[model samples]
Target: MWNGDGTVEVYGFRVFYSEVDCVRRIFEKYPETATNIRPKNQMVKNAYMNNLLDLIDIICLAPQELTEEELRNAESQLLELVEVGFKLDWLKNKLEELCVKKKKMEARGARMRELDGLIMEQRRVLWELETELKNEENEAVSDSARLGFEDVV
Candidate 1:
């Protein structure tokens, strides 16, 4: 077992060369079991779990080691961060869409204003032409009356 100060201690038993070779083979095949007291398959599974916990702890601490509970808490925090990032991306897209729509609306409004001004100018010209036509008609009628054209009604 490893002490907190980076030293390993084995209990009152001598390690055999054959056992060491077997342990080495097991560790090579399944590196996760290397940290267990007895390198059995079950211990290897537990060691894998412990290593996963340690990785979580390392990620949580950034520069230090963390406890198991801290690692679990960090998982939730990471999830929250991911959710926030997605929400931000969604909001950004919405804002961009709104901006494009607003620009289109402004452009259409400008075009409408231009068309209204053109229509007003055209109406003014038509009115002037109609007044001239009325004056010409009245002049012709007066001329015809002076000329005494009885059939020119």
Candidate 2:
């Protein structure tokens, strides 16, 4: 089934099968659990279907696939589980990393907001100071001119 984002979920496994022929061939070749097996009970086939459903559930609950950094270390694990493997640990670790990153990003965003507020406050204070300075200079010039200092020019 298409996952709506160009990804396909075949036999409950998310496979990046873009072409139809490759997907069809994989299904046709692996007909046991890969095809012709409904997730729901189909008569006495319920036993097999139940087992398949459990496997799918395990896969879904399992950790994400290995990253490029861990791919070498996970090769053997992946090979062992080709037919039965679920990367639960990898998925869990990735999720934890994501959570940590998200928290850091949120903290950074909050800090930036605080800095913005401080900058705005500073701007307001600077504007008031400049206005006061300008008024004081104007008054000084007017007072000097009124005190018969006009000829001093």
User: Which one is best on lDDT?
Assistant: 2
lDDT of 1 by residue, 48-82 (tens): 33343343334434322334455455455444433
TM-score of 1: 0.39
The alpha-carbon RMSD values of the candidates against the true structure, listed in the order shown, are: 21.2, 11.7
Please provide, for model 2 over 1-153, each residue's C-alpha lDDT reduced to its tens digit, 9 standing for 90 to 100.
776766565555544455445545534654543333333433333343334333333334323343433433344433333334322344344445544555566689799999999999999999999999999999998887754567666
The model with the greatest TM-score is 2
Residue-level lDDT for 28 in candidate 2: 66
Which ten residues in a row are the worst by lDDT in model 2?
78-87
Per model, how many backbone clashes are there?
0, 5
Lowest lDDT block of 10, candidate 1: 7-16
TM, every model: 0.39, 0.44
